[model samples]
Target: MAAGGVSPGGPLGAYVPGTSLLHRCPPGPKLLGLLVALTLAIRWPEYVAVPAVALFALARVPPRMALAQLRPLWLFLAVAFGFQVLAAGLGTAIEVVGGILLAVALASLVTLTTRVSAMLDALVVAARPLRRLGIDPDRVALLFALAIRSIPLITEIVRNVREAQCARGAGNNPIALAIPTMIRTLRAADALGEALIARGIDD
Candidate 1:
């Protein structure tokens, strides 16, 4: 997503330029730390707050940028939290929602501090062992790169669809939103597939 000078337009996988300790850290360690933190948070959701605060502080990312990472997910999180509250209780809902938020925040921190290329290189190296199982490390890394790139593309598509709907006073219509979003997403996928084929990546 950091390729060229184009911004991802959303905070999800966008790298923010900084010179903090986290930024100086290598992508492999950051990724390992993220996996560990997420595992711990999932196993003990009650303690998610501590790491959430610590990571954000350590990353030194702008407050607005950090918070923006959660903006798109808030609605989905809220709904899931409400379901948890009804199925279990307030404490359970808090733990569930807190863990989810912590996971997102931690992953965002890694991406924000580490460059996309660095992460892909680290992944390729880490996946080398999988070559024994007939898995191509470069292809695995390329797949990850495409997945990361798609997130922002999908986000932008949804945003544009929402804006257009709002302009037509159909902002509250889920059907209107879902239909166009799906259509656009499919078109984008087709274009991407064609591009890949043209580059001899059809296999």
Candidate 2:
């Protein structure tokens, strides 16, 4: 998020340079494949493993790096799996959790191999057909870009807030963490909006 001093393969967001098959693949096809795989994973959880493994291998993403990306989601995954187990059964829990992990892993691989600029350009091109429907492809692409960039920014904000809370002995108080994070996030949004307007992207 600092734009420097962060690993390209870090859990946040950055492109990892590689010469693997996935790295060589164009963003358009990679995105299409991701969409198909995600749909299939949702429909048939067992199918998730196949593509997950294949994608990691093709991307030449180290197992450690892939796991690093998932590390942050462990708590959410555990809670989801546990809730599913209590509500349904272990099999159902596995399917649900597996689908979620597969989705994240697949999406992570795409971002890992594809540069953000390249991905945004690909999105603009992909959205071109929607121009007939009164949609602006450039704006649509910009939205996606912002969403992608915001994830890491928000993550960093949360981390900083949590650290400050702990230092202040707030000890994981949800309100303490949430309020400051929300304020900081809003300020960030305001700054981003102003910057856009200054650039004449007010629309």
Candidate 3:
């Protein structure tokens, strides 16, 4: 399989299971705070932002996971920032992208420290006011749960597909690789749905 490699599970899916203070904090505070922090990041342009972002990132995850979380986006951030600098000289671009990085890192921190179930519950509760309408909070929560769970799940599929191709001595053909992976992923999704049903999560 001499074609290309995939990235690690991005920070959202790179949650390290642990019992740090971050891990112990109620999911609600983290979720609510994330919403507020994101609002500030988007609403305010002139504030010195990097340190706020850095502090947020450092507070939620282990040092090692923090480093790993930055791995996937490093090159992309570099290229985007580099283009910005080239296009408009350095200063403003540096300031802007640094703030952007913090926003991303903040999101990663929330996803990293919080469990998937907790995230699902938060989404459901937030949308609960819509329960009077046609919205089904439980189903919506399940959808979110599936969405978050799918990140690592799909990452695993790609990993397994690469390993399979290596064993079969097949060269890296995107179509061939993708087809089998897609089939396997659909099967996994169906199985997951069935399991949820069995557990009454779909009820």
- Model 3 agreement with the true structure over 1-203: per-residue lDDT tens digits: 12222224443356666676667777888878878888887777446366564654556556777767778888888888989899988996787687777788777787677776566676778888898898988778767656655766788898899889878876387776898899999999898879878988754
lDDT of 1 by residue, 29-79 (tens): 777888888888788766767867887788889989888878999999999
For model 3, the run of ten residues with the poorest summed lDDT: 1-10
* Best model number under TM-score: 1
Q: How accurate locally, in lDDT, is each candidate? A: 0.84, 0.83, 0.73
Deviating ranges (above 4 Å) for candidate 1: 1-13, 133-203
User: Could you give candidate 2's per-residue lDDT for residues 1-203 as a string of tens digits?
Assistant: 22443323554365778899888899999989889888887787686788589778877887887888799999999999999999999998988888888889888888888876788788788889999999999889778766666777778999999999999999479999999999999998998889789989975
lDDT of 2 at 93: 95
- N/CA/C clash count, model 1: 0
Give lDDT: candidate 2, residue 168.
99
Model 3 root mean square deviation, Cα atoms = 6.9
TM-score per candidate, in order?
A: 0.62, 0.61, 0.60
List all candidate RMSDs to the true structure: 6.1, 5.7, 6.9
A best-first ranking of the candidates according to their TM-score comes to 1, 2, 3
Q: Rank the candidates by lDDT, best first.
A: 1, 2, 3
Candidates 2 and 3: which is better by lDDT?
A: 2
Q: Compute the lDDT of residue 168 as modeled in candidate 3.
A: 86
Residue 171 shift from truth in candidate 3, angstroms: 5.7
Per-residue error for 162 in candidate 1, Å, reads 18
